[model samples]
Target: MATITKRSEDYSKWYQELVIKAGLAEPSEVRGCMIIKPYGFAIWEKIQAYLDRRFKETGHQNAYFPIFIPKSFFSKEAEHVEGFAKEAAVVTHYRLKNSPDGKGVIVDPEAKLEEEYIVRPTSETIIWNTYRNWIQSYRDLPILINQWANVVRWEMRTRLFLRTSEFLWQEGHTAHETADEALAEARQMLEVYREFAENLLAVPVIAGSKSPSERFAGAIETFTIEGLMQDGKALQMGTSHFLGQNFAKAFDVKFLNRDGKQEYVWATSWGVSTRLIGALIMTHSDDNGLVLPPKIAPLQVVIVPIYKKTEQLEQITEYVQPIIKGLRAKGITVKFDNDNNKTPGWKFNEYELKGVPVRIAVGPRDMKGRSVEIARRDTLEKKTYPVDNVAEIVDNLLVQIQNDIFQRALDYRQKHTYYVDSWEEFKQRIEEGGFVLAHWDGTDETEARIKELTKATIRVLPVEEIKEQGKDLLTGKLSERRVVFARAY
Candidate 1:
């Protein structure tokens, strides 16, 4: 068994140990790469299933796109190229051959292509370029497509399921007949992500637009969902960008309207990466180990048949079999652990480390009383319930656990989120860590200066709140409204 320490003492080490011990992910042979084990992949698969359904429900079609884009495609959009240039992994040579001296294999200069290629950090350039050839009429506009793929950003620092050099994600590219439609599409996806993050992942998020300085590279406006981790650091969970004719103009993706006039299509691109897994882990996991939400836990309920000897194992198994079947019938993922080698205490710690939401202990004592002990991962509370109502009680308890986690996070955010009307208070609270609500002059320079002084940046400007008016924090200059500022992941 893994001897894990409390998170309150050493949060980072606690997280690293929990991830490795839980059999979620581990570092790979290659630098900045991770091998996601079965448990981790199962969580990702659950996220994919939920997100895929939401995408389809909102009229998006799935498609595959090339991983490598001609280096020139990235340069087509000046701002985007500038923003991502430092992080891109460029392909200069395609083949390698043995040297004449036989020392080692060398890059085959002779096999080099005329133009270089880049592993896509994001698919905007390539997808937009393809849209140019695909659209010829207004009727053919609003090309809503998403691709499930791995992207490489050559991150200087890496964390599993967070800021890895390479990560799995879905990028949505949509073209619109008008700017309004594209903006609407971006907002729609933003809401979809907010719902998924809050309801399924049980992580509360602040959904709003990004400041000009923090907006996506070439996007006219960027909408994002920001979640605060238990450690008081903010995580930008997902983003939706409205590309108002910028991409369409750069790629010449024009469509002829019914008036027989050609007009550039408006566009949008949005995505959420494996980073959500990191957010989920930080949101609810405790010092003991991960405390997963019932909706996304691979094994919602793990039943441990605790018995003292081999002779008692048969009786425990007989009791567990019916309970397992009942839980499965009610659509709960259940696992029966009847292994005789490991002690009951050992199994309990193992499953707790793995973050199983509910643990049902059917021991000799409880079996005699016609009841079982149900333990909650989040609260670490144990209660005895009649065996006859095992299925129903477990089902309702799972739902309660999910809601409880979300509400706890929401309450924590409410308590920690501070509204600062003065610059001094903003700087002080930002150092303490947590979301600081402050107004801005809406200038990139001011934003950059604040970030230079303090690492915190505008997490998101509430779409609804920004519509109202407020004053600037620093200049006391009249401002549009407030935005959230925090040190982010």
Candidate 2:
């Protein structure tokens, strides 16, 4: 097996190596795209299942939207167009035919499209346009819909899950009757994402609103959950935007109110993408390989039977049957690897590299002692558990492993986070890494200047709305409160 580079030695290389070595993802023939392998996709499926349940619980419905968006639809929302225009992938020709020169197939000039279509970077424009037709009265005012699909942005510098040219994600677009309702929906979804990131993914994140300069384009407010990576950089886990009728007005999506007055519908759009997979990797994976949170690990428990003979293996299998049943009964996914082509030692290393939360090895000696050797991926600790009670012991161990990794990540964030009161301190401390908690002038020019000098941007602001008397580190101008600033993925 290929060795993973130590994170401390080279963080970027370590991430790329872990994604591939751990059987997560690899670059595809299409430049800037990725082929998510089965193991990696299974982790995503877990994320989808968890989030989908939460979304349904909150009264949202799953729907499908076209991947090809009419190019003209983007022109309706000016800010939206300005934000994503450069990255939009346009389709001009529909048909390809054999070249007269006999060079391979080529685009036929006669097949030029009447109007161009853009591979959707986002679904707001198309969905809003569709809503205009579906919504006509107060009863149809709130349209909460989400779609799970792949989108293209034509990125120049792509990194697997982080910023690929094409990626899979679920985008929620909702239309509401009032601003308050839209705002509440946006905040609600933000909390949903926060809960999933912290509880399901075992990733600790700070929930806050983005500054004007950092807010999603066309959104009056953009709420986000920012996670601190092991490299002291920030990763935006998810975002919920209160669009404030901008899209509705752009698309002429107006509905009659209770008072019988026509008004544009308030809008909110939120999403969590596969980039979250990148956040997961950076948060817990180590030099040995990935250290997946128990909840998200595809194969939470893997059992390898160690024996030199078929008879010994049969005994081990007999002993393993009930154990697997018990674990499955407890709702844990378990894999029994008794392939003869590979040795037990090889299977052990393989499972470790793949980040299985727990592993149990049953051998002749173990069977004689009525015990099974258990190991944890998080701490790499091994202990022998009574065979009869192994399932109960493992059930508890899985929760502990999840909590342990989250606590470890939280500790790392606290250790690396810094507070600065001056420009010199800001520059010096930022270079050292982690979230830089500092005051900003709360102006776009100041924010832009800070980013120009130091690559860090404001990751998030405290939701508690703390207002402290201070001066901006860069301008020495009047300021209130502090925001997290970090160079991000």
Candidate 3:
């Protein structure tokens, strides 16, 4: 029984404690790694199940790619190599040998490979290289493949599930015959991520494209979903990138068109990492603990028997058996906590910390009245309902809880978003850390300068630009419309 700190007192520490205390995850001995516990993995499994189904429905196939890439592949894309080189974890030696001094082992020079390999930060280089061999004709134009695997990025600072050195994610690599098709695929996946984040995770996000300076390393354009955390900071929940023909040209991934002419393939890659779990926790969780959305909660409803004596405990269990059966038959995941050592109040707090959406208390008094006490995790509101129609009430309340959480986040985003027409106002509003809508000169230098000064980058540019007359906030030049700017993750 660890004593959890109140979120209001210290939000960051509260998050650190909640994740470990609730059996979610823990920091590993490896400097920037985490061990996700069973409960945490269960949540990830649910996310994977839903996203996998959605990907399959969208004509995508699951495939595995090699984890290690020949170092030369990265250098083929100049910008990409420059962007990722600093964070790459390179594999220099293949085997180890005992030293002459007999103290420990040393790198075996005799076993060195002809080429070094780099652990992938992203799969673009390797996937594109593979595509060159697989694609040859117009029939093989659209190669939609997704891979579920772990990627390593050597970060100086890391947090559990947020910025780990190694984390699990699903990366989608698709090749198309035309740039238009590739762009459409990227946007479509962005929408899928937005829907999942909003509906399943109960975290509202703004969907849009990244600016030139903020786009992915080799991507011609990048789309993103940004969510606001309870601490007033922004988190980039997911990203989809349109690769144009850059990757195809680098890897010589060409195919014969219907007219019998060789043409390079258009490519797109997108992914949402374990960082989403971090966003979900920060968005809807409270001082009590995490409040998971019912759609993805491992246990949607928990039934705790409250009784004074052994005889009453049996009666409470007897009364709950049929209700549990009814709920489980309707596809609800329910858990009956029958541990005799812990009292009902203790069990209640435990489940609340674990974020079970709904908790039902069945006691001797409630059994006498043919009723049960139901508590909603989101609002901490409790209501006594008759057992005769308990199943229906539980089902309806679950749906309501999901909707309410999403609406609340939406409302917060609306309230915090600010529109600025001048540089002074932009600087002033950004200090407080929220979305600032401002115009730009549409240059990489201007975007970079803004970031250097305020640490706020262009989070996204709308697909359809808003028609408004304004000046560039930094450059003092006239502009057409404003793009979204924020100090992002």
Candidate 4:
């Protein structure tokens, strides 16, 4: 009964409608929070499974940290504390009591704790504090740990998944004896994220290092993967930060070096969150509904039985039983919808809206002819195939869809990307929206002035930058190469 708003008509409205109408997520009773529905959570679980396996294979271990930190812990790192000071959710009292009017509970002033606690915006402070105790010598030098948890930022403006106050994510905090190793770990995880985004999510991304102005607080360098959305805006898909001993020094976490000298541990922290769901939606979903990559889709192939009466339906079901068994045997997530309450047409529409990669329709004519009709969600194209080895066909088709969509996204990004050499051209392209590649004077003042005139910020400095002599677009100052700039989500 829900109608989808066209993306061209209203992109923001279309996103909210598709998220709720398609049973993905909804806003929660708590302000700025969301409840990720089962279908949505399934996608998140797939993301977690892929990343977790990769982390373990790369020698990272799973660990848990406390959700609340003593307020004093945040002050250890000056820049880190200042960065999150405005968003920290503080807990001042420990207990509550009935109000005088007997309406609701109120915080009991008498039960106030000696110190306040901060709900974690990020776990860098608390994790480093604990690391100080666990580490002693060179043997404990490299500690690679990741935790699956929720964080709070108390955002003023909130969307379903993009800027929610509370969201689920996995944060990786690691320590190494040397800066080179820590930097390598940071770059390695960024590569992991780029692979997951492009291959599994079918969203092409640009992986690079962040500018000083855009780098994470207290980090020496920040690596990121930015995805270009359908609306021509960039979404930061993931980030990895090289902390460079800022956290280690803050928490006094020191280890005896190989030469028996006490030195601070080099650290790194990287994470991706539910905001990725928003990026996925913006990158691929159409006006009709969500279009998920087959690799991560919860329901890959759906079998809908079509018939006139009970006996005809029975025949269709029996005929399709072997196909179902075959697909399941091949480890394809599939469903056979034979419910009488919904018409075959209704089921088809529902699956399309839910973004099922492939839909197999079995009817009397098709059954008699020993063939089935398959509909692909990506192209909205249908093909008839003989029932012989249909499971193998669907499996191969799913792979094709995944690769095709990623290529399509990659092509779109290439087309939208602009190379502007002059100031006027840069302004015009920034307004039109896409990545604008231009030179900067390499000064924070120039960057801030450019942002004041145009909302776009430097998205990333490409890791493999081509050294072409150029002048700053605004100030005409000397520059080595161009950096990517865009207005991001």
lDDT of 2 by residue, 231-274 (tens): 88899999999999899889998999999999999999999999
Better of 1 and 2 by lDDT: 2
With candidate 4 superimposed using the best TM-score fit, by how many Å does residue 65's alpha carbon deviate from the native?
A: 0.5
Question: Model 4, which residues run further than 4 Å from truth?
Answer: none
Query: Judged by lDDT relative to the true structure, which candidate is superior, 1 or 4?
Result: 4
Candidate 1 lDDT score at position 318: 89
Over 4 Å off, model 3: 98-106
C-alpha lDDT of all candidate models, in order: 0.91, 0.92, 0.91, 0.93
Candidate 2 whole-model C-alpha lDDT, 0 to 1 = 0.92
lDDT ranking of the models: 4, 2, 3, 1
lDDT of 3 by residue, 340-397 (tens): 9999889999999999999999998899899999999999999999998788899999
Q: Model 3 Cα displacement at 169 (Å)?
A: 0.7
Ranking by TM-score: 4, 2, 1, 3
337: Cα error in model 3, Å = 0.2
**Any runs in candidate 2 off by more than 4 Å, and if so which?**
none
Give the higher-lDDT candidate: 3 or 4: 4
lDDT of 4 by residue, 1-489 (tens): 656999999999999999998899999899999999999999999999999998999899999999999999999999999889999899899999999999999999899989999999999999999999999997986999999999999998999989999999999999999999999999999999999898889998889999998989899999999999988889998999999999999999999999999999999999999989898888888987989999889999999998999999999888988899999999999999989999887887888888999999999999899999999999999999999889999999999999988888899899999989999999999998899989998999999999899989999998879579999998999999989999888
